[model samples]
Target: MKTKDKIMIFFLTIITFGTIWIYWNSKKKNNKKNELSRSEKISFDINDLILFLGDINNIQNVENTHKKVKIYIKDSNLVKTEEIQKLKGISSTLVSSEYVNIIVGNVAEFLKEELSRKMEK
Candidate 1:
């Protein structure tokens, strides 16, 4: 093949691969960002709830009025039962698993209260 033709072909190949790489990387980044922004629904096992209440003490009026509890945590899925227990254990009133309903505006609070109530039993 002529030198000019070969050079043209090489450049075209490079451009095509570069475009594909950039597109792929951008798409991957967008997906990661979306995942970070999305909210997560977390379900806690009964045992984990008990451990959480042992840690937190400030939580008051913890009552279990629902058979099942579900909460939405925005932008995070990591929940430590130990940390929740620490916060609820500090509450002035003893948590009860029978009739207490701790309501919060955010997912973290909801989980904290629910776990605290479960532990109270």
Candidate 2:
């Protein structure tokens, strides 16, 4: 083969490899970004939930029952039912005249613990 042909093939191979490398790196970065955003969203939801329940002070008690977290509030009027319903992972909310009940699938225990810790602090 001519030297020109050999050089062309080499350059073509380099270009192909460069494209693959760039694609792979971009995919990895995108995966990381997606993971970060998901975690941030969960954290934001938990924090916002605390506020919607009328802060740590208003929460008199927290109970976890499988997929549900029942929060006893000092003043039911302070709870924001509309905002709580809009949160991402909240499966359902059962607001009574005196308390707040939220279902967050398997994260109920975690939610209860977070609320308890916040109250302690």
Can you write out model 2's per-residue Cα lDDT over 4-52, one digit (the tens) per residue? 9999999999999999999999988877643211111243467798889
For all candidates, the clash counts are 18, 0
- Residues 1-121 of candidate 1 have per-residue lDDT tens digits of 9999999999999999999999999988877643212212344354544434343232333333222233322212233433544443222222234322323223434455645565475
Using lDDT as the measure, the top candidate is 2
Q: Provide TM-scores for the models.
A: 0.32, 0.63
lDDT, each prediction? 0.44, 0.82
Clashes of 1: 18
RMSD of each: 12.0, 8.5
Q: Which candidate number maximizes TM-score? A: 2
Window of ten residues with lowest summed lDDT in model 1: 68-77
